[model samples]
Target: MAAKTNPGRFFEDYATGQVIHHAVPRTVKMGERALYHMLYPARHALYSSDQFAQACGLPFSPLDDMVAFHVVFGKTVPDVSLNAVANLGYAEGRWITPVWPGDTLRSVSEVIGTKQNSNGKTGVVWVRTRGLNQHDEVVLEYVRWVMVRKRDAGAEVAATVVPELAQVVPTKDLVIPKGLDFTNYDFTLAGEPHRWGDYEIGETIDHVDGVTVEEAEHMLATRLWQNTSKVHFDTSARPDGSRLIYGGHVISLARALSFNGLANAQMVVGLNAGAHANPCLAGDTVRAWSEVLDKAETAAPGVGAIRLRLVATKGGAPFALRDESGKYLPEVLLDLDYWALMPI
Candidate 1:
């Protein structure tokens, strides 16, 4: 008897506006939260201590923002990027609500746009994915585009319509978690006294910390997210013969390193845009820096939104992003723009 298994969807199989409901709803717990901290130097006080969260008006500490993002993003891999060449970029990402330890999450993706590449071997597929809790509440949603291989290179082409995504999430659309009140935010326990007002637009802060990536850590982190991208696991997948570190791993590391200077900038509520400017491999020493982009007052008491440009580099010159020719410098790994909640 022949057994059936999923070979995953190829570029030719996807059409604009197609919706895919992913499988396997995952239930999170304290163990997941604990392991997240161990995997990265994540020490955001609001997500680490129940008492500290209570002080800010949350009933209890919620899972780290990256945890929720990884869990949700993982569920879509098998269905979306199982045979992808590379994840190109992200835009219009927002966390609508806090994901608690007990919450169960699942993902659904809608193919918003697709364009066949000139090479004919692959095409770009853009999807808007939503992560929803058990109660059907949307926890997060974002738009991502990936390069996917075609089942048949000679297949007839269709009209390519690339969806126009916002360059940045509007400040008015940012969601403040229920019961969040930073008015009483404790600077002493929060680890830094710098509030939202302390940061000047365009000010840059270099996080004075670096971590060398290891093969084991990269593999574990990729598996933890259930990310099935072959390039991240199979070294033979790339000509360099080096396993590429998951971009999310680098993002988390950069965010954690920024803690020394941005400890008070808690709660990542918006992701305006992100790009894995260059491939990150094991043995690379990753360093990070942040530039204040903009600021906005949130509807929640004591909670304000501060926009930042977080750049991760492989020992690049501090604040060095684009090269003289307008391309990202080879030493730069990630360039992310997002909004975080901080005490006003």
Candidate 2:
């Protein structure tokens, strides 16, 4: 039998119904909140001002849901998808609760299904991962699939069954975070009155701007999120001794960058999927590009729904991400899909 796999690769020396619990529990802090402000230019008074949030009846401005998701999801990359050929998709994703600063976050993934591809050299694995806060409440949960390479091309094929998944989560499945009472939601500070009705299908936005990340900024972010993966810090750990920038840093930066074009998207309604197309290191200037995929009207009087593709990359130019190989060049960091709420 082949030896155990490397830190992040999949090996045939595995079994079905396995459960992989990733290591490293993290705690969020003020540095993360500061970066969220700088990155997204998120004008939500609740997130930007503790006093404002308190006046609005919140104890404090909690981390944005997407930020929480990014922090939680980043932990799973090494153990789950480092060797993935393609990230198939997501289903049954929900943010069950809020993640406040100072909360510790950890993740656990249960292998829901596994199958061998007819091509013989590869297979697909499906997992349901949950993010729990320090309180042990499920803050986020999602089902995802990845195309993984097989250790032995000639290994006996187990099965070829593909699991069924919903293209979009049902409306009832949308778990609005507990204690999220938008009744007191401050519309003026939220930046726009546009709600679920104003966006037109196929609209395009140019969230114009970029921010160059520095060692200090990335390290601060990684530490705040409690993501202790040494590659993100402790530069002396690597052979070249370079620190790897945290992926959540880039995601927040890009989402914040999206504000230029998507200023009206006040609330995130759904997350269809996302990707870290490439690794980003410190000193890279990041910028963003957005394309509206679809739109719908919402029940919120002034709110509308807009599906958007948000892409981020390093210096050179906005929208210039891939090389001739059709691969995400070194500078490209993220490609994400999601739904946002805007004013009509």
Candidate 3:
């Protein structure tokens, strides 16, 4: 039987200096690339057209950076936060490198701080997680806080303190993938010429397209990210012997699918938050829906900021996702909020 774990824990369980090395290693492939395009309708010539990527001096367009982050973070969920009461926030997040198809990924986390809550039922644990590529180079890093349950409600309380963190990463800390030079970026195939000035706030878009994932596809994807969690790959390891799809795969596929309607969104600027509403399994056909949350002018001449809500569902008409509780359906795999850069 698969091991059972309680992700939620009291502050007393953590120490000022602790390290949690997550399990699983994932690998990326062309199937993921094809799915990304079908899902997002991303028209970034580099990601969509091989010729365009070559012109920009890359062997090929690599998988999006967010894809890597999602893969790495998903592996930690069962081990670190399955029982979490709340996710406080993130800090010091950075992408240090690019991830191409065929690359492997893994992750490790360290406890940076801890605090006891006055309520006594829960406490906060601060951890810094680092994602590493197959080459052992750091690809991404972020600090996050979670409210964990106390093993003993009556346990004596210790120190009550919280560590401070930056609200947003500085511009210099944003790592543009190596060899990325927009100098030769194509406006025609890239889908829009409206640099930074053309968007209005509160615009809603419907990205149209659907994809059905197979057990093989998700297993390969999770393995590429170096995420070896058995639930995602080992059917025999579970009571049902059914493999669970990686949440990041669904997120990446949904974001990529968002490209159909949001083709002008060229880069992700901010990530507000995200959730995987239900378990995804092989043989599920996935479709996407999106709504503009807000908009803002950016410093980039041709780029404007568009906040969006992206959702993914299984086997239904567009937007046909909700659960028995009348909430977002259980087949709905994701609900995400983020900011993207679009040409005005």
- Candidates in order, TM-scores: namely 0.98, 0.71, 0.65
State each model's CA lDDT, in order: 0.92, 0.68, 0.67
Tens-digit lDDT string for candidate 2 (1-344): 98685556573534456677776888888777777666545564445676655644457777777677767877777777665655656766776677888998889987777887768788888888899988889888888777777766887654454567666554445544333344455566666564444455656555667788888877766655555555666667555776667666776787777766565565565667766787677788888887777776554443456677788887556556578998877766787777765545
Better of 1 and 2 by TM-score: 1
RMSD of each candidate? 1.1, 5.2, 6.3
Those runs of model 1 whose alpha carbons end farther than 4 Å from true positions after fitting are 1-3
Query: Over 4 Å off in model 3, which ranges?
Result: 1-16, 20-43, 48-63, 70-108, 112-126, 132-138, 143-185, 192-198, 236-241, 315-327
**lDDT value for candidate 3?**
0.67
Which candidate number has the best lDDT?
A: 1
TM-score of 1: 0.98
Model 1 lDDT at residue 314: 96
Kindly report the root-mean-square deviation of model 1 from the true structure over all alpha carbons. Answer: 1.1
The clash count of every prediction, one per candidate, is 0, 16, 32
Candidates sorted by TM-score, descending order? 1, 2, 3
Q: List, residue by residue over 1-344, the lDDT tens digit for candidate 1.
A: 77598778889988887899998899999888888888889988999999999998989999999999999999999889988988889999999989998999999999999999999999999999999999999999999999999999998755798999998999999999988998888898888999999999999999989999888988888887888877888889888798789889999999999998999999999999999999899999999999999999988998889999999999868998996899999999999999999999
Between the candidate structures 2 and 3, which one is better when assessed by lDDT?
2
